[model samples]
Target: MLVRKMDSEVLVLATDNRGKIVELTDLLKPYHLRVLSTKDLLLPDPEETGSTFIANAKIKALTAAQASGIPAMADDSGFSVAALEAAPGIYSARWAGPQKDFNLAMQLVHYKMIISKSDDTQAWFTCALALAWPDGYCESVEGYVYGRVVWPPRGDNGFGYDSMFVPDGKNMETFGECNINRKKLISHRADAFSRLVNRCFKGRNFDGKRLLSFRQK
Candidate 1:
């Protein structure tokens, strides 16, 4: 089937999370697209019923794309510890409970690791990105950044479990401790987003120069 061309430049991001909106908007800065979040449009969030990151991302993307009659993008990401056998792989956010208190969630993770009596600190963050058109056509990709979990959670820069994750090869600085530019350089979201852009936006008539102009505004 022939995929419909994206005639509109506006792309709705299917998420209400402010942190995600900021990260995604920053990532898409180079593209000649106007980004809008579900919160900005006051769109209802679709339930993430999928079993995996890719599936969940597709659900959000398709829902927003169809609802707004425009192309949309969504991201589903999580933190998994090797010792826990990735218990919170998909339920990372749920671990924070209804309050969305990630501090409590981090404490829970540390507690679980202690109860398990496993010394393994090996962990990883996974990100899945999905891009969907109004007609339901979609593309999805996943990326990962392997690292080890730290104790006493350091830094206060990033959201979620960033304070505890120290990506491999970094100078022992947790994501929360690193500046946004440094974190973006090796983040799972950045890896997946790069692939998505290459797959969907490359070779298009997107004006690269507009990125500079948009930033200036």
Candidate 2:
């Protein structure tokens, strides 16, 4: 069973990516929870030695919660391409090199697929979210979205591999080309968040739009 203790309004969000922060903040704003970034707290980044997304998320959440002495939440997301046998699943960030140049990373994926002549460009995005309390309580949830890889990339809106990822059934719009609202609705993070809300936040109203506030007293 999933649960969130209602004692604290301050929750640390453990990520340095501003895009992720903005998206998460927008989604969580309705709950009236005060979300603080690791940067805001001057928290150090935890080493993601985990071999999986869930493990990485747990490592981050727990690290932040223990360091900041507050409740913390973290997420790990990545692209898993069928052709590459999920080559970049856990190494998604590392694949971009130290500078985080995703263009090179995307090119790497594109070439590997081409060289293999793997007609199947099928892929999916996976996101794992973990929430941890300072006293050691923790919970995690995962979500995914299936899609196909597109070559040469397109659009300039999103970061990472967004420009080359076209969700299934879509003719031409990569996530980068789509509007923020559309992307958010079908994103892996949103899917994970829905589960997180259902499991942890019992009785709260979340209709995927405006969230009505309900708190445990």
Candidate 3:
């Protein structure tokens, strides 16, 4: 049964990414913690205008915490394309276009490389998870997974750029080509969430706009 209480030691994850939710579900459950999503509260999502992944994650976390007056969490992450000089970094979502055309985004990347005559298809996935308390305190942890980009696409399992992301040493397929358990083992989001579990604890204090303070105690 869903509990209804303001002071409950709950975590409001500030994201709408279902893939991430699925990836993080198990890691969060062991704490016996109440996990809530923006969808559950019908909350408005904040605009991710931050220039960096950390900045964006923090923005969303604080927004949810402030909006719901509870401890909240968020993650902002994407792929860094080496050929494009790490471009489409913050633009990963937009690259898929306003309609989120994953196919077009994949084609665009391949086309860009094919035209450039550069096979530097090295890329990596990254995610930064931010946690914030009602008092305005916030903390964040990051995750990274190195991988290579594939051109023809691969198996269909994961979503958004996954079909074209092939991890190093395994030339078999893309992230979409791998199963959920396999994906979790080497995914960036998984790494970040793991860090959160290690260093994170309840209760903290707020510093200011530039930053906030969170402690193990």
Give lDDT for model 1: 0.87
Instruction: Report the C-alpha lDDT of model 1 over 96-132, residue by residue, as the tens digit.
Output: 9999999999999999999999999999999999999
Taken over the whole model, the C-alpha lDDT of each candidate is: 0.87, 0.85, 0.77
Highest-lDDT candidate? 1
Model 2 pairs in collision = none
Ranking by TM-score: 1, 2, 3
TM-score of 3: 0.85
Per-residue alpha-carbon lDDT of candidate 2 for residues 1-217, written as tens digits (9 for 90 to 100): 3256424567799998988898788778766777899999998998999988999999999999999998888999999999899879989988899999999999999989989888998999999999898877888999998898998899988888899999877457998897888888888999998888766664543342322333343
> Can you give the TM-score per candidate against the true fold?
0.92, 0.91, 0.85
Best by TM-score: 1
Model 1 residue runs over 4 Å out of place are 1-7, 206-217
Which stretches of model 3 miss by more than 4 angstroms? 1-8, 201-217
